[model samples]
Target: MSDDANGRRPSIRDVARLANVSYQTVSRVLNDHPSVRPETRDRVNQVMAELNYRPNQAARALVTSRSQTIGILAASSSMYGPASSIAAIEAAARLRGYWVSTANIDASDPGSIPEGLAHLRAQSIEGLVVIAPQVRVVRALAAQALDIPYVTLQSTDLDVDHMLSVDQVAGARMATKHLISLGHRGIYHLAGPQDWIEAEARMRGFLEELGASDVPTTAPILGDWTADFGYYAGRELLRVRDFTAVFSSNDQMALGFIHAARDEGLDVPRDLSVIGFDDIPEAAHFWPPLTTVRQDFAELGRRCVELLLGPADGLESPSPSTIAPELIVRGSTAPAA
Candidate 1:
């Protein structure tokens, strides 16, 4: 039994001795080398079972030239996009037999993204995935030297080797077009920060829908994609007194809009119609229940991994892709008042 300085006991040597085999034989069995006979493997397995031998992670990494780890640099917390995307990537990576280590970055700061990337590279990470949904992050990636195999989530920039995003434009179109179909002519939008790629795409989709239809377009109200911003924007909606239906950039903003509508003594779906994007879990439980566009962030993560591992021959073909958001019709949206 080899006890480390910390007094942990029972190393591979102890297992080999107990199994009546040389340490080299035990190494072969542990490393899945084919030289070991099945009977010897069975005996080693019995010894390992009895002694509870575990290999050191660092030693294994050195031998195989692989860390068996993936690095993820992501925003600490902004909304469902960053948080949900990280969770999805972690889960999918684990399923592929890789461990995930994450570094949190400030969503608004370009420097934070690269700083996190530096930390990950220092760890000798084999691959890097960035969950940067904002424009700052996009620009940071373009300017930095990301030499490792890299993938970006929630950004549409094809300049990167691999990229994936929820079809934000399509989602916005779904949200706005849905409102238009409900007979509302005066529709308003609470857009997310202009610096975020998703926000820009969503805003574009909303405007394109209005432009394509007979209904007129009002400038989208800017919001920061927070419940408070939504709430405050909701309050502003009361003063405008012109638009009958409002489409918010995300569910958090939608929640604020809902609260603002309630506080202003207006009935949902009766006096005003409201819809949102992201279709968050709580969206269905709002006062009148929300009708919004639902995006599959988990699917997006899986797709990112696939794209990162995809064949590199098709460099010029349609590499850019989009995942469309599904519209969930709920009680919050109704025929215009």
Candidate 2:
């Protein structure tokens, strides 16, 4: 027992005694030493929890010579994918007993990139997870070496250090193919803004799928991934009366387009078909129920933590991974009417 000002505080020895193990066993459990048995580990953990014991982070840091902190440079966190990824990263980091420092930047603004890095640097972050989706961020990182270990979370033609693209191209292809297979030939596209790696990859997949079938595509409407822009895009698209189906880059845009179509007295699936990517949680619960592509943002975030820290249990390197997307069909899409 360690003596506090007023009373004897519970120490590792006390926990060990309660758990019927040596203090060395408690220490091993705290340090996550691999030699301990699973049942013993559970017993020690239960004892610690029962005692409400908290480890001394300062002593652990001194022993490890690490701050035990990771930094996240994320963009478009208001959107579903980025926001979900950020949450997953935070959760994963917490499980590993590491602190997270996050810096948000508007991906469109180039000036904020280095500034965000500087903020994390000041915090002495041991590793970095960069989730900026723009190509320029990749270029900027390449131009100057921060000399800190970092992993990027987007597709880049140039080989970036420890970067993973989640296969937006494949996801987009799946989205387009779904529309095409439903007999929608005159399909228009709603895409994210330019200079974004994900937007570009998705656009490429859409066009490639269409080209393979000799189906010509209309000029795409570029919009930020927002319901407001989706509404604006929907209003603009109503003037061109040729298309019977639309492929939106994300679900919020699809919802906006639906609202726009309904306002124009056009019923979904009866007048037009719509498909969107990133099957957000609300997609299934939407009025018509959206047909969308599902990206595993949670998996992406877990992979980021694994890559930033290290792969567990003889796992291979985490670079060059692209999670495949799945197509979810719903009432929002149908055969061209």
Candidate 3:
């Protein structure tokens, strides 16, 4: 309740003096040590609050050798999938009473991977979550030989013990099968950039399903996972009027493709059926309400936290590393006319 005459920030000693406890007791309370009595802990917390004492996380980490922080080394963080995963991880980490520090890296620059890792490590992060969606980024990460527990959000068959992700291949297959069931033999796939892991997996699944069902397959068009690309590609592809349906890599592109369809005086599902992946928040609001594949990004984030920091308070067992994606059918497609 008293202000320091020097007008300096309150320190742990000040908190201990005000709380009538030893300096060690304040440290234990800061660390959440179980040995501290409940009443004493409450009293010290009250004093800390009254003094507005903020613990220096860096100092605490050096002394305790446990930062109680998780680091996210992310590449291509601006993209929807990676960005969503980052948000999910941060939320999950907060639920577990830990802080999150993120270091965004240019995935194209191999040199930046180590620099990003070093920056996070300097904070003494106890665990790491990697949002590397490119094969090259994953490869660059694997070379680091990190000493702490880490989890990668993409499935690359490398360090399976540390990998967690939604099953992209299966999700794509679900999309393709949905179209095939609708009696659309001529289907085109608008895939993500060739190097992206999710894009490749989805394209693979699309081709696999078409081959299995005897539906003739055409070479997929590689896209940059943008609405602009989708609109342009759709304008070009629709000129030929070859395929009855198109499965876009993500909802953004699907939105663009639908726009192009409208421009060309075509009615969706009546003349052309379109589907997309990721089931972004806007997907359901798209004109005609796009039908798309949904990945449980929340679950993926929770699992990443669990994999790195152990299951949350009451979780007795860890969830599987690979989450299955769900097929969300909306108004985007109907029986092929």
The candidate that wins on lDDT is: 3
* Residue 54 displacement (Å), model 2: 24
Model 1 misplaced stretches (Cα beyond 4 Å): 1-60, 76-78, 158-161, 309-320
Local distance difference test, each candidate: 0.79, 0.81, 0.89
Task: Compute each candidate's TM-score over C-alphas.
Answer: 0.78, 0.78, 0.82
Superposition error at 159 for model 3 (Å): 2.8
- Tens-place lDDT per residue, model 3, 1-337, is 4457877778879999989997667876775655689999999999988987866665688788789999999999999999999999999999999999999999889977876776676567899999999999998887776889888889668668788999988999999999999999999999999999999999999999999999998999999999999999999998899889999999999999999999999999889999999999999999899999999999998888988888767667484479999999998898888
Model 1 TM-score relative to the real fold: 0.78
Best-performing candidate as measured by TM-score: 3
State the weakest 10-residue window (summed lDDT) of model 1. 309-318
Model 3 C-alpha RMSD vs. true structure (Å) is 10.3
Model 1, 21-98: lDDT tens per residue? 976677667755555799999999888877666666534667888877788888644578788887887777776677
RMSD of each: 11.4, 12.3, 10.3
Candidate 2 lDDT tens digits, 1-337: 3444678667768888899997767766775555689999999999888777755543455678787889888887676777777888888888888888888987777766766776566455778988877777777767645667887888776655577657888888888888889898999899998877888888999999999878887777888888989888888889876899999998999999999999888999889999999889899998799999998877887788888788765588566577788889999999987
213 Cα displacement, candidate 3 (Å) = 0.9
